[model samples]
Target: MRLMDSSEAITIKDVRSARRRLEGSARVTPLLEDPHLNAIAGRRVLVKAECLQRTGAFKFRGAWSALTALGEGARERGVITYSSGNHAQGIAHAAEELGIPATIVMPDDAPALKLANTRGYGAEVVLYDRAGGQSREEIGNRLAEARGLTPVLPYDEPLVIAGQGTAGLEIAGQARAMGVTKAEVLVCCGGGGLSAGMAVALAAEAPGLRVRTVEPAGFDDTARSLAAGERLGNEPGASSICDAILTPMPGELTFPILSRLAGPGLAVTDDEVLRTMGLAFQRLKLVTEPGGAVALAAALFHGAELADGPVVALISGGNVDTAMFRRALDMLDAAEPGAA
Candidate 1:
């Protein structure tokens, strides 16, 4: 599919329309505050709890927007997509609600909870082996063609980006309500969909706000791309514990907006992510998957380098497996000198 020019692709108007479309379906998640987080950052910290969103991630907003925009004929043909987990569940859930058939191409080793949740949403699950050199995009595309199904791209399309932008609208409004006029907004970056979409929305709704993309250390493709002023891909052997945000590169449709409006990208280590996850549980009383906690991690660990006043971190998902959550807590304990 051809990528749309950022200038004409999606706008704040589109995001508003998506918000209207999702009025009854998508919950307007709360913007949470914690004094401990603020003390750590030495500034006010507001967390956008998108982990409470339907399907346990923010991906549902885009999936619903894209699926709902399809014409009757297209919806009848069904839809196909590829996601590590969140987007898979998002599309599957949306498809089920709209009475459309859905198929998801997912990694074979994706977190067991996410895998089970995706299937629980009633979508056919097609698994690909990451270690065996399998490509999800190729598989999804081939299946789409063979089955006459429409492909719902995870982050590369205008509609999807606009849908994701709705979250930014909420953040802007919520921050304003909390008397924050100027702040730095940190969004978890996978293929740059959420970050790029928020960039566009914030540019229009809250011009005083600055946006930053957060990623895992080794998979900072969006960070490198933003610095180089061109799209860049991660190394072939790149890997991270934050599997939910591990895309090869920034999306073609998302990079332009991010390049124009987003501030510098921030990267955090796996250990930092684990610590942040533990912190969320202990302090915020929230369950955040590792990828979802990267922005919070950046806020806690790298806030000094970010803007002043207030920092808004997007907790993008909460679909972590039980074993993974236990391991993260274990890592946090091991890092504490006096911990058992």
Candidate 2:
């Protein structure tokens, strides 16, 4: 599917419309003031607790937007989509709430909690091997075609990206309510839908604000793509401790906007991600995945220039493996000069 062009794409206006459509369904998670986060970074740091969003991630905003955007006939046929995990749950939850059937093709390597949550919403689950060499897109497409289900993309479709942008749009409102007009907004970007949507929204609303993006270190495709001015795919098996930032390329729609609205996709290390994850829990009292922590990692390590940021680091998601979550906590424990 072709991604939306920044020039012709739906504006933040559309995103707000979607958010309104969601009304009371999707959570308008708190824009938390973090005194500890501020003290450590030596600058104001705010976090949009998207991890508190329905489905435990900002995916709820996009999933609900896309499902609600569908017409009666489209909803009748039901919807199918692929996800690393969070989007699957988002779509499934939306479909369940809307009384539509939903099916998802998910990676076997996807987080177990997300898998269970998706199923809990009554969506049918199909699993595929990440090592099978069969692409996730291909697996999802085949499943959709075979079942004659309408396949909703995780982040590629225009409507989907526009839906995802609602998070940023909401953040803008929250930022304003907090008596701030603009600050650098750091969004965690995988395939760019969320960042692109936010970029468009924040650019239109905040004007001078910087909508920066953060990605994992070894998987800095968004940063590279912005620099190269082209879509660049990921290297095969490029590993990151932040599994969610594994996408090789930015979306076509998300590229120009990211380059234009966001300064550049910032890259942060797994170590930094772990530190940020622990810090998020300790300071913000929030559950954040490694990918989610990338933005905070940038604020912690890169400070000052990323923003005089009354900055909203979009805490992307919270569904991390139990063992890995402990490891992240342990990393935090070992952070200083000695072991605990």
Candidate 3:
């Protein structure tokens, strides 16, 4: 396939194609309405529960989309990728279903459940130290070259971004079914694939909808990059409990689309994320990881600044370690009355 210009790489047509590719393979995760969340935001709040998606996250949609787009020869040659957790599981699961060999290079500190699930999905796992000055992309690429395998990036590629856009299509349709004409969407921002892809889909399908990328406080590179009108990187040593969305920089391909279509970004602290996760479990009856709940955090805490109409928050994943989940619950328990 001939490569399109970066700006045009992931178009509405591509997203629509991805939706068709994902028709039976990917679940149309529910758009949940939470009275408690609505009460908190003081407006209608719809939650896209991608946590309940296959492989426990929306990454599966993009993974399947990218893999299906590859030629048969490439599929036989295998695929490799680097991810903190959710993307790893997505790729692994897709590869397994396609009878393709898959390998994932994951951070040593990735959530235990995500690591286990990625391996359980039949991918070879290679753990790398995030603090050891080792580059995950370099390692994954080197491995791909050695094994003659295709390199599937966690974000940045057009196929993957288009695949992620499938979720946006569902959101638009579901919102319309719920009688929502205009709304702002809050998506967890990592390297911008999901946010950028959703922007494209919503632009075509729900022109009245606005998109905002949400990130952890210390690692809000996408947020800052949008404000600076250029790509930017986060501090190398910056850390957060929201490990799933801890990408160091905005993706080169995804940023341009996001810059053109997305609204100002928003961020929330780790404490807020944990509290939101706890609230999701208690109120929404949904298990949400810190990273997945950041968008919800922004909605609950910064909704007024983000939008005035109905707000849709994307809960991107739910791959939290048991201990960490318990800690989040503990934090909720210890909070001041009515804090959660």
Best by lDDT: 3
**C-alpha lDDT of all candidate models, in order:** 0.89, 0.80, 0.90
What is candidate 3's lDDT per residue for 45-162, written digit by digit as tens?
A: 8999999999888999999998988888888889999999999999999999999999999989787888899999999999999878789988987888788888888888788899
By TM-score, the best candidate is 3
- Candidate with the larger lDDT of 1 and 2: 1
Query: Pairing residues by index, what is the TM-score of model 2?
Result: 0.93
Where model 2 places Cα greater than 4 Å from the true spot, the runs are 1-8, 304-309, 337-340
- Residues 1-340, model 2: lDDT tens digits: 2223335766777877877887889887888887767777777777888889888888888888888877787788788988888889899999999999998888898878888989999999988887676587887777667766777777777777777888877788888888878688888888888888888888887775678878887788888788787878777766887766677688766687787777867888888888888888877788888887898888777774564546777887888888878988898887765321
Q: What is the Cα-based lDDT of residue 154 in candidate 1?
A: 91
Model 1 ranges with Cα > 4 A deviation: 1-8, 335-340
Residues 1-340 of candidate 1 have per-residue lDDT tens digits of: 2223445677888888888888899989999999878887788889999999998899999999888888888888898989999999999999999999999999999999999999998999999998798999899889988998888889987778888999999988999999986999999999988888888899999998889999999899999999999998988886788989999899888998899999999999998899899888878888999999999999998976797678899996889888889987887677746331
Each candidate's TM vs. the true structure? 0.96, 0.93, 0.96
| Alpha-carbon RMSD of each model | 2.0, 2.4, 1.7
Could you tell me the C-alpha RMSD of candidate 1 in Å?
2.0
Per-model clash counts, in order, read 0, 1, 0
* Candidate 3 TM-score, true structure as reference: 0.96
